[model samples]
Target: MSQTRSSAVFGKRKEPHTIIIAHGDDIRHFTVRPWMAALCGSVLAAIAIGYLLATSYLVLRDDLIGATVARQARLQQAYEDRISALRTQVDRITSRQLLDQRLMESKVAELLDRQEELSERNGRMLPLLEKAAGASAGSADIPIPSAKPEVRADIAPANAYAASAVTNSAVAALARITKGSTAGKAGSASIADRADLMFLTINKSLREIESRQLEKIRTLTENAYKTADTIVAALESAGLEIDATYGSSDAGGPLVPVTGAESFDSEVEELDEALSKLDSVRDAATKMPIANPAPGRVVTSGFGVRRDPLIGKPAFHAGIDFRASIGLPVHATGTGTVSKAGWNGGYGRMVEIDHGDGLTTRFAHLSEIKVTEGQAIEVGQLLGLAGSSGRSTGPHIHYEIRRDDKPLNPVKFLKAGKAIGTLL
Candidate 1:
């Protein structure tokens, strides 16, 4: 009986419990099973555990955030490294481009400098070229492009304009190339190559111009020397020795020894020397009394022993008489200063000119005296009218050429005048 009672207690302990609640006239009852109680306890335990887990998550939240941020930072660093690498590659390419552009620019600049130098040289040589062209006007071998008679009066304008055009073209080409380069255009290398070719062409053109100028100058120099030599020979033929130092008597300068390689300046100096020699010889020829005193006149009286027309006797005739009509113009034969322009003892209305180097010319038996004493005279200037004055027969004039008061034959002088005229 005690064992049964203990088993009943154990069964009842495992059975559901009933609880009742009453209010005034209403009553309600609920049966709570042992499983329900266990479920409730389990639910309560689950809630407590969830709360503890939530609290732990809240405590470690900052660490988790830090970890996530660290990962993001690493990713960002990797991305930044990649970007830097790309930028480095771009910079290298840019650097190479810059180097190439600079090299091209330097080459172009060098070419420009050379062109400018050539232009300056041309500017300085223009006057000389023009002078040479004028001196050698009939020369055909010299290829002076700008030496035209119509334009010879002004050659500088055309040449200067052409040079300016070339410079402008070069500047335009440079601008185009620079613009393309700045715009990062393609085919920059080809542009630079074209620029080089164009610049080379310009340089070649300038060289050709210079070559033509040099050729002209050379021809002119040769012709000037030839002219000088011919004049000297003519003077020697006329019994006049050309003084070597005729033009250098008053010239004085420092004796700077020539010490340089042959160049354009040296060539120009040689040309100047040749021209100077030509001028000196020409001056000497001019002072010689070798021109005809009275052209187109018949010589009635001769020099040396001649029969005098008035005296009807053999007399020493110091000059030749030309048959002329009264009031006919008489001209001076050479350039000189008149020393006598009055009537002399035997010569009437005599006009005597003192040419340099002891040379004198006399025109006598003139009806009129057109010059005064101590008057400067030139060749072909009218001296007086021809007529029969003193010791003259009919209408005749006596012309004389003397050296140091000694009479010389005028025939040889007139012949020399013809020869000199042909040469000049």
Candidate 2:
């Protein structure tokens, strides 16, 4: 086999190897060509390279695994940090929202309190306003505003839970709206802001109402004063001097100018004073026999100078003659005590009442006498029935007002009565 291998090696392009195996007396021979040898060598080389590479990998396996693990750990740490940052940002946003909500709630509560106060004030002024309206002769009635508060509680949430309970989609929508533009933020109003504005408006309206009330009271006071002055003038014109100390005693003090901002209390006080004065004047005027004795009766003959119905000649008439029907109900024109109730010559069935302040009223030609002598009588009280008794030519009444036993024209008193009746 050595000699055959040595001879085969001498050939170059025709290189071939023979393998001979001897065992006992049997021999086996195999031929190996160059291509076959090369194939086997390539196969062996591939197997050797695989073994070396596997060995190298096995030697540095710890480093490779360590690098892989380190890289994975770094990635995990980065992800954790990002998650923590996101969580912190969410916490900050939630805290800020909570703070803003608390502030808004406080503002809403304060506004509600103000609204309640204004409502109460309006309620208190309602009666006074109604009184002013009644006293006004011809004016629009002042209407009281509704007492109910205009602000609603649901406009602003009372607690943080209400805000927190909002869904994510709703929160996002709100954020979009709030952050849309700077102009939107400036121009738009929140629920709390709207509530505050309503309260302010209500307060302003209440102030205006109070001012109107003051003005009404002032007007009423002026009217009352004017009415009193007119009554006094009428009394003086009819030769009746009013007592200087009629209502309140004369008061003197430094004249303090009234300020522009008049209070309701102050205006109401002035009105009451004026009303008292008016009442006193009216009372004095009524006692002076200024009221008509027979209202709605036609005066057939006026007092002073008239042709006598019986004589048909010029005569000085002491009283006005009213053409009244027989048995017509007659009322006392003034409050006084009956001094005479029996028949008198030329004054048939006369009823006389002596009022204080030296004033007396006489009703003659009565069909029936109801009041007795010394009986108390008030204005508009039933005195007797009308009839053409003795002096009267027909069914008529002779109404006379006398001061200090001197006859005065009854037309003057009746005219004064008509003028003062409007105020009363």
RMSD of 2: 10.1
| Count of clashes in candidate 1 | 0
- Write model 1 residue lDDT over 143-173, tens digit each, in one string: 4336423213234334545655776677677
Question: Each prediction's TM-score against the native?
Answer: 0.63, 0.59
Write down the worst ten-residue block by lDDT for model 2. 151-160
Return model 1's CA RMSD, one decimal. Answer: 9.5
Error of 2 at 104 (Å): 5.0
Q: How much is 233 displaced in model 2, in angstroms?
A: 4.8
**lDDT per residue, candidate 2, 315-419, as tens digits?**
999988888999999999878999999898889999999997778899998999999999998888999999988777789889998888999887777777676
